[model samples]
Target: MQNDIPVAVIISDNAEKEEDDKLPEHKKIVADWLTEEKRRYGSSLEKREREIIREFKEDPSGVRILIVVDKLLTGFDAPRNTFLYLAKQLRDHNLLQAIARVNRLFDGDEQHEAKVNGFIIDYSKNAKNLRDAMALFSNYDPEDIDRALLNTGEKIAELERIYQQLHGIFNTVRNRKDNEEYIRLLEEDVVKREIFYELVNKFIRQFSACGMIHDFARKFGEKKLARYQRELKKFVELKKIQKIKNAEEVDFSKYKDQIRRILDKYVSSEYVIELSEPLCLSETEAFNEFIEKAENGLSIKSKAEAIAAQTRRTISEQYHKDPEFYGKFSKKIEDLITQLKAARQEDLKALLDTAHDFQTQVQNYEDSDIPGELKGRKVYHPFYRSIVSIFSHYSVTSENICLVVTSLYDIIEKNKIVDWAGNIEVQRKVNLEMEDYLFDVVKEQKSIPLTIEEIESIMSSFWNLAVRNR
Candidate 1:
């Protein structure tokens, strides 16, 4: 019956090359349905984007279609974009952002309408298994939500019972526990704790998205667990209101806000701290040394120290000019630049100036800093080339761009030593890694919230395999 509904399928990628395409034809078909009515919308983007955006602009009854393989997943908007057919596996903030595509309001649509209207008709077999994953954080009630989930109703009901049992155990503990209630409490604690942990593991199995999991985990598992009680109570209250059919314009704002607060708290406390601390420490140490040396009243290091520093700088410059080196780092830089250009609201001149600065630095390094060992024989500069490439990819806030370029320069100065024979290879390798470091900083500044793991797997992988080769 669901498939029997009149649906317009949109095909963005060539259906024949299903494996080669990022999204399969089946999934792309759903994406295409959402954007089928192109001209009805204000302006036309790529035929691909139009296909995705059109569904929102014009309402064609019974037109329940699917789209396959498209790039309009981000930076596009449509109020009628109520249904998001997610065939893709997403993680971190990306998962949230993608689903958010359908969360915007329509004319009479209020909070719950906006929230629940964002449906995902998932045909992707893998995606079906992961349906309950996001619901844990999105405050989605398994029963209230439609056949949105792919598994058996009984399986989902069982999972709910387990959660309910855990809640009951928690309630039992709350009811008693005098000074002498040690043994029973401890025994129950172990059982309850196991259930709690198992719930977390099961949640993870359903939702690969950490932003969703970490957000819900803290609410249900960590600090102020009373909030979870409150939320669950609210869920019960909402079900009653819906059942009465007398609830006019349900206020999901309070509930949505509570969940959002939990998410923010989890992100700030759990995810960001553990993931970023180590990298931040390393970057700070390297930057601190550079700042201190640059700031010293005057400069006349001991001969030994000067020799060591100069040799290191020389080796770094030599490695920068290596052909293999350029082969590796150039395209990542360009991709970074392109993303900046696309995302940011900056003046053209300012962007060009930043690009010029990167270019000048690269040229200067090539001509003056590259070691004589690799001179006259056509050496490449992957680090500098990468800088240029990344600059091209993104259009960033001027201040952010300034910070990024300065950071890139600092990384080169601190890590790369062109003259040192002993450290040339090491410096070169570090520069290669710096691409990853610089890319993350730029992405964050652009307000693109990605997990370090996602950054490494998606953006970094894209950089290394596609950008570098191109």
Candidate 2:
């Protein structure tokens, strides 16, 4: 017996109303256990219950089992809660709700097991026949209920099928065992990679569910399952790299523990590198070191992807403030990636050099031509950049653009109240005033005739920058 597992026992409460305070025998047992547990932590009963629930939801070692009868059968959702021990009879909605407690898909992370399927250990003998227990669902047909609960054997079979399908996608790889080969193969074929990833995810889910049932692993063969786990871990690592390079957000909170476990079992410490946090482009040394480490650790294509993704993120953050400067780098990075992909003969050294060169360009952009005084004005800088970019193309001089932008910036800043972005009426009034200033004062004074479309475009750009930066 695993006594180390944390458990919450939900027994029947005899008290029907707030005035009635009678307790049942099972409730007393549960209460005594809670009291003993609380003494160790030095918390009150109410405080302890809250802690238990929190731990059950978050910390893996905190709570292992929740023994519930009536309470938490519905309206309670804890994705990490993997098992339920049923000691009381349940019917209809009650049974459906109770079983659903463990059905949540959980990603395995550092602290807990990846929840595959909710398990029920029935001691009440009320759910002996699956159909009989579910027959009370008058609203749903028998086929619907059957679809919800697949037997262990059926789930195992599905897992095996998916595993095979995943391998079949990688048949083009000359060396299936080579991690680099698999990475290259996946990078080249977008459709195949997508299918492989989807199939493997499906396989992991089914495999995890089947793992809870006794003799299921034996029936599937432990050797084969271990092989799948090993291959899955490799694919997951490659997937992470791909995601990072593509600037895709990967949420690993639920599955981090499970992924860590797989890597610990199969991969060496030298190979186990956690994804680096978002790098600050301003910190030249740190950013360079990040790129260097990535170059050393990853394939050329992977390194290129990571650099491009990070550069894109940097541009996205600073683009509004210095659109002209950052926008150029954004286009440059995009072109570099496109050129790299189109190259027939891949040169690792050349790719690495080009990526570093791009990083250098991004870092050195502060030296770009922008008036020194306007650089310090954070809020107004974006409007100035927008004005410079829009008007500089025509007869409008830099000196005149700066003067008009400065005045407009002052007028907008003064009128912008607290939460002005949320107030549409204020925005409308501000827009009208800015348009009047642009056309009446600036346009007439500078003798720069503008079309309605051009005026609207410039105003729209300036207004958006102001609101977003605000």
Most accurate candidate by lDDT:
2
TM-score for each predicted model, relative to the true structure: 0.21, 0.70
Which 10 consecutive positions of candidate 2 have the poorest summed lDDT? 12-21
Q: CA lDDT of 184 in candidate 1? A: 31
Task: List candidate 2 segments past 4 Å from native.
Answer: 1-5, 15-64, 69-81, 87-115, 122-155, 216-226, 260-297, 309-327, 344-354, 357-381, 389-397, 422-461
The whole-model lDDT of each prediction reads: 0.40, 0.66
Among all windows of 10 consecutive residues in model 1, the one with the lowest summed lDDT is 240-249
Candidate 2 shows a clash count of 10
Quick one: best TM-score, which candidate?
A: 2
Give one digit per residue, the lDDT tens place, for model 2 in 117-193. Answer: 67777777645445665665555577765566547777777877887787788787797556567767777888987
Clashes of each: 54, 10
